[model samples]
Target chain A: MANIHDVSKAAGVSVSTVSRVLNNHPYVKKEKVEAVKKAIIETGYIPNINAVNLKKGKTHLIGIVLPFLDVPYFSQLVQGISQAASVHQYKLVLYQTGYDEHQEKEALEMLKLKQIDSLIICSRKISLETVEHYQQYGSIVLFENGEDTPLSYTFIDHYACFMRALEYLYEHGHRKIGFSVNRLEGANSSQRERAYRDFLKLKGLPFHKDYIFKKCLNIEDGERILREIAAFQERPTAILATSDQVAAGIITSSSNYELKVPRDLAVIGFDDQPIARAMQITSVNIPLYSIGQILFEQAIAVEISHKEVSTELMERSTV
Target chain B: MANIHDVSKAAGVSVSTVSRVLNNHPYVKKEKVEAVKKAIIETGYIPNINAVNLKKGKTHLIGIVLPFLDVPYFSQLVQGISQAASVHQYKLVLYQTGYDEHQEKEALEMLKLKQIDSLIICSRKISLETVEHYQQYGSIVLFENGEDTPLSYTFIDHYACFMRALEYLYEHGHRKIGFSVNRLEGANSSQRERAYRDFLKLKGLPFHKDYIFKKCLNIEDGERILREIAAFQERPTAILATSDQVAAGIITSSSNYELKVPRDLAVIGFDDQPIARAMQITSVNIPLYSIGQILFEQAIAVEISHKEVSTELMERSTV
Candidate 1:
C-alpha cells in the first residue's frame, strides 16, 4: 500500500508539504497541491478516518438529537452546545429527529453502533426504558428530567417556573390567566400543565379548557392567540407565552386587534431572549446556553449525575 | 468473529430479533433485550457499522459548515437542508466554524478522509480557490456565488438585488441612502457596496462614509444603528437593513428615538422572514429555504453545476 512518504516522493515534494496538502491546510502552493493530488491518484493511496477511529474506539464526535432548528429556543440551545463543543475540539452530528420515534431511535442506534462517542438528546419521543437500555453502549445525557431512570440529566423546574409566573399574575388581580404551549404531549409541557391545574385548584379558580392554547411555538402564533382572545366574549386578562418570539408577536400586533398590552391583556414569555429584552416583555430567564455547557459536560462525564438548573423571572413591561 | 446469527443462536432468538436489538428498535420485550445483550457479550459479537461503510465507500452523512446556528438566516437554511436530507436518509455533521479559516479547513479534511460523503458550505471565510481544490475528494457545494469556479453553487444576486432596492428607495423620492452589513469585507457585502456606489453615481448623489453600518446582524444591532443615526447631524433619508431582524429592531426602537418609519426615514429589509411579515417590513425576499434544497441536491449530484436563485421585492407598510 502507498504511504504518505511514497506520495511525497512521487510528487517531488517534502513529506510536510504532502501532509499539509492531505490535511487541506491553507497557503499551500497551487502547484504543490495539484502535484499531491496527481500523486495520490497515481499511487491509489486512501486516507481512512473510519479505520483510525475504529482502532481508538473513539470517533471524537457527539451526536445531538434535536427536533427543529428554526425555533429560537432550539437554535439558542444549539448555539450554546456548539460553542462548548468547539472549545473542546469536538464536532457534533445533528440528528434532526423532528420528534419522530424512529428518528430518535436512529440516534440511539448510532451510539450502540459506535458511530458516535456520546449522545445528547435535547428532546426526544422515545420511551425512557428504550433509551436506558442503550446506556451500556456509551454515555447518554438528557435535557429534561430523567427521574428514577438512572440517566444523566440537566433540567429546569418547569412546574416551579410556571407556578411562580402564574402566582405573579394572580397577585396582580388577573384571575383569568391563559398560557401557550408547543407540543401538548411534551414532557416540559406536561409539567407546566400539571402546575396550571394545581394552581387553579389551589386558588379556587375556574378550570377552563379553552385557556390552554396549543401549537404556540413562534412569533406568528401570538397573533393567533390574540385573535382567539378577541373573539371570545370573556377573555383572559393575562397569558403566558411559550417563547419571547410569541410574546413580542402579541405586543407588536396588539393594536391591529384593537388591544393594549398589560391593559387589555398582559403577557409573560419564556426564554428571556433578546426580543423580549428589546420589546420589554416580562420573561422567565432560562439559561439555555449555560445549560448546554452543562449538558455537554455530562455527556462526557464518567459518572451518572443529574443537575437541576434554576430559573429567574425577568420583570419588565407588559406585565 | 461472532456475528448477528451467532448471537441470535446463543440468545435462543431469531436473527431478526438480534438485529432489532442491535438497531435499538423500540417496543422490544425487555427480557429479550436483556437476553440479547448477554448473548452478545458472551459471544464477543461486534456490530461494526464503520467497517460496513468502509467497504461501501459511503458514510451516509453530509457535513454542513456555517459560521453560526443561532442566526435566523442560517437556521432557516439548515431547516430546509435537514428536511431534504431526512428524505434522502442522510444525517448531518455540523461544523460550526465561526468563520475561522482553520476550522473551515477541518471540514475539507473530513471530506478527503471520507468521514463525510459531501459537504455544504452555507457560509465561509475561506477563499474560493482553496475550497475548489477539494472537489476531487468529494462533492462540495456552496451557498454563495461560485463564479468562474468548477464547483456547484446556489446563490442570490446580491448586486442586482441591492440595485433594485436602491432604485425603489430612489423612486420614493429619497436620496442619501445607507445600508447595514454583518461583515464589511464579506463577498456579498462587497457586491452590495459596489451596487450602492454605482446607484449613487447614476443619480449624481454624494457618498457618505459614515452612512454604512458594519457588524449589524441581530435585532439588538437595530438599536445601535438608530442611536448612531440619531447622533448624526445630517442622516440619510433611507436605509437598507441586512436582515428582517435588524429592520424589526430599527422600526421597533425608532419610536424611542422619536423617529417614524417612512416619514423620517424609509427602510428596507432582507430575507422576508416571518418577522418581516408580522412587522410589515418591505424586504427583498431571499428564498433561502428553497436555495437550501438546491444546495443539498448539488452536494449529492455527480456533476458540477452553478445555480443563481432569484430574489423578489416584498412591498409592505415600511416603504
Candidate 2:
C-alpha cells in the first residue's frame, strides 16, 4: 500500500535514492541504502514490479518455447536455462506448445507484444519468417534447430552426431541398421533423417523404407518402434534412436522378447540423459547445461549490445 | 510503444472506450471494438503489459519454485500448469531452486517484492516458516508435501501408495522387500519411509535399515540402490522404488547381471510415468496433470476471491 514517495519521506532521502536502493544499484551510498531498507521493512512496502519493468523499458524475463516439457531432453535443457538465468538475475517464462503451430504463433506474438524481453526457442514448430519477425522486437535464440537465419542459436550438429553414431555402429560390425526418429517436421529431426539417409547411401548399403519408423516423441514411441521391429520379417541387428529415453524404451521392451542388448540388438540413442548413464545406453551426450549458459550469455549480449549471436556444440559419450 | 491514448486517437474513440475494449467489458459496442482492432493493427500498437499489470495490482505471473525443471515429474506437472494457466491467460515464471536455500529465499523475496503474483512452493529444501511469510503477499501452493497447513496443496497420498505396493508384493509371496527412496528431508520421502517401516511391522517381518537406500532424485539413484541391493548378503526378492524411472534403472541394471525380473526380482515403483507402461514396471499411478489443473484452479480462486483453496487426488494406474 505504501508508495515510493512514502518510502522517500520515511527514509529522509530523494525518491531517486529510494529507487536506486530498490533496484540494487551500486552507485547508492550504504547509509542511504540502509535508510531505504529500514523504511521498506517498517512500511511493509512492496514495490510494484510492473511499474519498475515499465520504467526500465525491459523486463528481466526470458521466454522459453519448448514442444514438451515432460520429456527428458527439453527438461534437461530447461534445467540448464534455469541455472543460467538464475545466475544472471533473470526469470524464465515457459511456453509449452506441445509442438502446436498455433501455440508457437501465440508465443511469438507475446514476444512481439513485449510480454517477454527475449525468447529461447527449443522447439522447431515455427517458420523462419515468424522467428525473423519476432527477432525485430528482441533476440530470438534457437535450440537444436540448425537453420541458417538472422536469429542466433545454440545447437548440436545433429547431422554430424547422427553420422558419427552410424559410423560407430558400422565399425562395430553392424551391417543391418535401422533408426527410429520423431516426425520429420522440425529442422532438427529433418537433419537427423537426412544424415541417416546419406550415411546409408555413402556406405553402399540398401536403405529400406521399412527400417525407418516415425512416431510422437517420448519413451512410449521408442517402445512402439521396438514392437514394429519385432513384427518385421527381417529385422535390423542394430538400431539408432532419436533420444536416450527412447533407446531405454527399446532396450526394456526388447528384454520382454528375450533379446539382450549388444548381443542380440545393439542400440544407440541421442541425448545422454541421466537414464542413459544409469542404463548404460550408448548415446550422443550433448552439453545441455553449456547450451543454457551460451544462450543466456547471448540473450544478455543481444539485450545489452543489440547484436546477433551464433551456436556451438559440446559432445559427450553417445557416439 | 503506443499507449491507450494513441490507439484511442487513431481509432477516433475515447480512451475509456479503448480501455473497455481492451478489458473485454460487455458495455463496449462491436463497432468500437472493430475500430480499436483496426487501429491497433494499422499503427502496430502493442499494449504495455507492465502498465496493465500495474493497474490491475497483479502481475498475472505465477512463480513455481522447483528443484529442477528437467525432471519428468516436475516437468509433467509444469505441462499441466502451463495448459491450465494458458486457459486463464496467465504466464508462468519458473524459479529453479536446485535445492539451494539461498535460491529458495531469493524466489520468496521476489514474490514479496510483487515480481510474481502467486508462489507455488514445490521444493523440499525450504522450511514451513519461510513459506508462510510469502503466503502474506499471495497464495502459496504446496506440491508433494502434505504437512497439514493453512496453505493450498496438491499431493498424492504417499502412505497409501506405498502400502498398496507393499501389500501387492506381499500377496504375491514376496516377504523380503527392499525400498529405494530419494532424500528423507522431503516430506513425501519421509511418508514413504514411514509406510514401509509400518508395513513391515504390521506384517510381523523384521525391518532392516540396510535394505533401505536413500540417494539423489534420479534414475541413477535407482541404479545405485540396485547396486546396494546386489551387494547385500541377503538380497530382497522384491523392490519398491519411489519412482518408475528408478524401477526402470533397477530393471536395466539387473539385466546386466542376467537377473530375470519377476523370476529373480519383482520391482514396483511410484508415479507410473509413460515409461512404466512401456516397460511394464508396475507402479503407483498419480494424476500429475490433474494436480497441475487443481493448482491452477486454486490459484485463480485465491486471486479472484481472496480465499484459501485446497486440493483433491485423482487415482489412475500404478497399483
Candidate 3:
C-alpha cells in the first residue's frame, strides 16, 4: 500500500535517497539507509517488482517453453533449469506449448512483450523465422531441437546413441530387431529413425517396414506397439524404445504373453531415466541434467554478452 | 519505447484520454479511439504492464510451490494448473523446495515480497505456522497435503483408496501381503501406512514390520524392496506398492528371480497412472487430472472471493 513517496516522507529523506536505498545504489549515508529501512518496516512497504523491472529494463525472469510439463523428460530438464536459475537469482515463467504452433507463436509474442528477459525453448512447432523475429527482444535458447541459427541450445546426439544401441544388438547376434518412436517430424525422432534405417542398410539386412512402429511416446503407445509385435508372424528378437517408461510397458506386456525378456525378447530403451534404473531396462543414458546445465549457462552468457552456445552428449548403459 | 505521453500528444488528446482507451473504459469517443489507435501504431507505444499492475494493486501472477518438477505425478498436476492459468490469463512463478525447509522459507519470503499474487502449495515441507504467516499476502491453496486448515485445497483420499486396495486383495483370498511406501514422513504415505495397519488389525492378521518396506517411491526403490523380500526366510504372496512405477520395479526384479505375478507374487499399486494401465498392474486408480481440474477451480474461486475451498476424490481402476 505504501509507495516510494510514502517511504521517503516517513524516513524524513528525499525521494532520491529512498530510491537509492531500494536499488542498493552506492554513496548512500549509513544514517539515511537506517532511516529508509525503518520507514519501509513501519509502513509495511512492499516494493512493486513490476515497476522496478520496468525502470531497469529487465525483469530478472526467464521464460521456458516446453511441449508439456507432465512429461518426465521435460520435467527433468525443467528441474535442472530451475536449479540453475535459482543459483543465479533468476525466476522462471513456464509456457506449455503442448507442441502446438499457435501456442508457440503466442508464447514468443509474450517474450517480445518484455514479460520475460530471456527464453529457453525446449521444443517448438513454429518456424525458425518466427523465432528470429522475437530474437531482437530477448535472448533465445533451444533444448533438444538442434536449430543452428540465431540461438544457442543443448541437445543429445540421438543418431550416435541409436546407432550404438543397434550396433550392440547386431553384434549380440540379434538379426530381427524393431523400434518404436514418437512423431517422425521431431528432429530427435527423425534422427533416430534415420539411424535405424541406415544401420540396417549398412548391415545388408532387409529393412521391414512392419518392424518400425511410430506414434508411440507414452505407456499406452508402448502397449500398442507390443500388441502389434505379438500379432506378427515373425516376431523381432529385440526391441528399442524412445523412453524407459515405454520399455517398461513392453516388458510388462511380454509377461502377459508368457514371453521372457533376453530369453524370448530383449528390450533396450533410451533416456536412462530414474524409472529405467529402477527397472534395470538397459538404456542409452543421455545427459539430460547436464544439457539443462549447459543451457542455463548459455542463457546467462547470452544475457550478459548476447552470444550463442551449442550442445554436447553424455553416454550411458542402454547398449 | 513510446509512453502514454507520446500517444496522447500524437492523438491530440490528454494523457487521461489515452489511459482510458488503453484500459478499455466505455466513455471514449469513437473518433478519439480511432485517433488513439492510429497514434499507438505510428509511435509503436507499448503499454507498461508493470505500471498498470501497480495501479490495480495486483500482479495477476500465481506462485506454485512444488517439491520436484521431474516426477510424473507432480508434473502432470503442473500441466493441469498451467493450462488453467493460461486460460485465465494468469502467469505462474514456480518455486522448487526439494522438500527443504530453508527453500520453503525463502519461497514464503518471495510471496510476501509480492512477486506473485496468490500461492499454490502443491507439496510443501514448511510447517503449518510458516504457511499461515504467508497466507496474509494472498490466498494459499493446498494440493494433496489434506491439512485441516482454512486454506483451500484439492486432494485424494489416500486412506480410503489404500483400504479399498487392501480389501480387494483380501477378498481375492490373499492373507500374506507386503506393503511398500516411499517415505514415512510424507502426509500421503503416513495415511496409506495407517490404513494398511488398520486393515491388518481388522483381519486379525499379525502386523509384521519387516513385511512393510519404506523408502520405495521409484522403480529402484521397488527393486530394492524385492531383493529384500527375496532374502526373507518366509515371503509374502502379495505386494501393495505406493505407486505403479514402483510396482513395475518389483515386477522387473521378480522376473530376474523367475518369480511370476499373481502366480508367485500378486502385485497391487496405488495411483492407476498410465504406466499402470499399460502394464496391467492392479492398482487403486486416483483421478489425478480431475484433481488438477478441481484445484484450479478452487484457486479461481479463492482469487475471486478471497475464501477457502476443500477437496474431493474420484475413483478409477485398481481397487
Candidate 4:
C-alpha cells in the first residue's frame, strides 16, 4: 500500500535518493542505501519492478515473434529459447502473429515503444526492409537468413538443404519429385523453390505446378497431399515434406488409401523431430532448439552479426 | 531521448498532470490532454510503455508457468492460450520451470512484484499453500482442479476420464491392463493413479507395480515401454498411455519388435493430438486448446471460480 514517496519520506531522504537506492545505483552513499532499505521495511512498501525497469531502461524481457506455437518446429525453437532465457534470468514475451503482417508489425512496434529489451523473430511475414527500419530501436534477431541486412540473424541454409534433399532423391532413381511448404511467400520457401527449380533443370526434368503443395504444415495436410496426388494422372514418386508432421500424416493415411510408404511413394521430411524418429521418416535435421538458443543470444548481443547453422540428413526407412 | 519531465515542462503542466494525460486518466482536462500530446511530439518524447504501466499498475502481461514447451500437450495449450490472449490485446510471458520448485517460486514472485498482471499456471510443482499466499497480489489461474483453494481454475476431470478409459478397456475384455504417467507426484497424475486403483478394485483385478510405467511422456518413451513389456514374463494385454506422443511412439516402434497394434496390445492414449489421429490410435480427447482459452479467461477474471471440462474417447483402430 505504501508508495515510493512514502518510503522517501520515512527514510528522511529525497525521492530521487530513494530511487537511486532502489535501482542499485552505485553512486549512492552506503548510509543512504541503508536508510532507504530500513525505510522500505518500515513502510512495508512493495517496490513495483516496472518502476525500477523504467529508470534502468532494461525490462529483462525478450520478444519472440512466431507464426504458431503448436507446430513442432516453432515449439522446439521456443523450448530452446526458453531454456537459454531462464539461464540468463530473462523471460520471453510471445507474439503469435500467425504470419499476419499487422501482427508482426505490432511486435516490431513494441520494440520501438521500449516495452521489451530486444526481439527474436522465429518466422515472419513482414518485409526485410520494414524490419531493417526498426533496428535502431533495439536488437532484432532473425531465425531466417538476414545476411544481406544489418540485423543479427542465425539461419540454416534452406537452399543447400533443399538441394541436398533433392540430390538424394535424384540419386535414388527418382526424376519426378515434389515438395510441400507452409507459405509460398516466405523467404525460406522462396529459396527452397529456387533450389527445386534448379535441381529439376540440372536433372532435365520438367516442373509441374501441381507438385508443389502449398499450406502443407500439419499432419492432416499429408492426407490432403495424398488425395491430390491420387487424383493426378501421373503423381510424383518421391515427395519432400515441409515438416515431419506432414510426412507422418502421409505415411499414416497411406495404408487407408491402398498405398505403401517408399514402395508406392517415397516420403522425405524436414526437421528430424521425435515424430520422424518414431515413424522412421528420413528427414533433414534442422536442430531448431539450438537455433532458438542462438537466436536468443543474438537478440541480447551488443554487436550485429549473422551466423549460418548446419543441418544433417537423418536417414530412416520412409525415404 | 526526451523524458517525461521534458514533455511536462514543454506542455506547461505539472509532472503528475502529464502522467495522468499519458495514462488517459478520466480526471485530466481535454485541453491539457491536447497540450500534452502536442508537447510530446514537439519534444520527441517517446513515452516509455513501462513508465505508463508503472503509473497505471497494469502491465497487460500474463505469466504462464509450464514444465516444457516442446511437448505436444503443453504446446497446444499455449497455442490456444496465445490466440485468446491476442484477442484480448494481452501478451504472454512464459516461465518454463522444467518442474523445478525454485523456478515456480520465481514466477510467483514476478506476480507479487507487479511484473505481470496475472499468472496462469498450466502445470506446476509448488504447493497450493505457498501459491495461496500470493493471491492478494494478483489473479492466479490453474489448469488443474483447485476447488479447495481460493483461486480461479479450469480443469479436466482426470479421475473420471481415467475411469472411463479403464472401463472402456474392461468392456473390450482386457483384464490385465497397464498405464503410464510422467510423474507420480503430479496432482493430475495422482488423481489418475487413484482412478486406476479404484477401477482395478471394482473389477476385482490385481494391481501390479511393474504395470505402471513411470516418466513415460515422449515418443521415445513409448519404445522404452515396449522394451520393458517385452522383458516381462506376464505382459499386460492393453496399455493406457499418458499422451498421444507416447502411444504413437509405442505403435511406431511396435513393428520393429514384431508386435501388431490392437491384435497384440490394445493401446489407449490421452490428449487426442494430430499424431493420435494420424496413427489411428484410440485416445481420450482432452481439447487442450479450448482449455487454454478458458485458462486465459480465468486468469483475467476478478472473481475466483472453478470449472470442470469434459473429455471424450475417440474410438480409433488401435483400441
TM-score of chain A of each: 0.87, 0.82, 0.84, 0.94
Model 2 misplaced stretches (Cα beyond 4 Å): A1-44, A144-147, A172-176, A255-265, A303-319, B1-47, B145-147, B255-260, B303-319
Off by over 4 Å in 1: A1-44, B1-44
Q: Against the hidden reference, what TM-scores do the models get?
A: 0.89, 0.82, 0.83, 0.95
TM-score of chain A of 2: 0.82
The DockQ value obtained for model 4 is 0.86
Q: Give all candidate RMSDs, comma-separated.
A: 7.2, 5.9, 4.8, 2.5
For model 3, the stretches where C-alpha displacement exceeds 4 angstroms are A1-43, A145-147, A173-177, A204-208, A230-238, A255-266, A303-319, B1-48, B145-147, B172-178, B204-207, B233-237, B255-260, B263-265, B303-319
B134-228, model 3: which lDDT tens digit per residue?
77777777876445566777766778777877787788788888888866878778888899899999999988889888877777777888889
Docking class of 4: high
Candidate 3 chain A least-lDDT 10 residues: A305-314
- Model 4 residue B298 distance off true place after TM-score fit, in angstroms: 0.8
lDDT (10s digit) by residue, model 4, range B149-221: 9999999889999999999999998999999999989999999999999999998999999999999999999
Clash totals in order: 0, 5, 4, 0
Interface RMSD of each: 1.1, 1.8, 1.8, 0.7
Better of 3 and 4 by lDDT: 4
lDDT by residue (B180-246, candidate 2, tens digit) is 8778768888888989989988999998888887874577777677777777788888888767778
Show what share of the native A-B interface contacts model 3 retains: 0.73
* Candidate 2 CAPRI classification by DockQ: medium
lDDT at residue B234 of model 4 (Cα atoms): 94
The C-alpha lDDT values of all candidates are 0.90, 0.78, 0.77, 0.92
Q: Sort all candidates by TM-score, best to worst.
A: 4, 1, 3, 2
- What tens digits encode model 2's per-residue C-alpha lDDT throughout A1-319? 7888899999999998998898888988889999999999888788777788877778889998887787777788888888888888898998878778888887788787677888888876767787787777778787654446776776667788788878888998987898887777667778888998899889999888888778746788777887788888888988888788788788777877777787888888777777777767787777777777777777767442222223222232333
Model 1 lDDT tens row, A134-216 = 89889999999998788999999999999999999999889999999998999999999999999999999998889999999
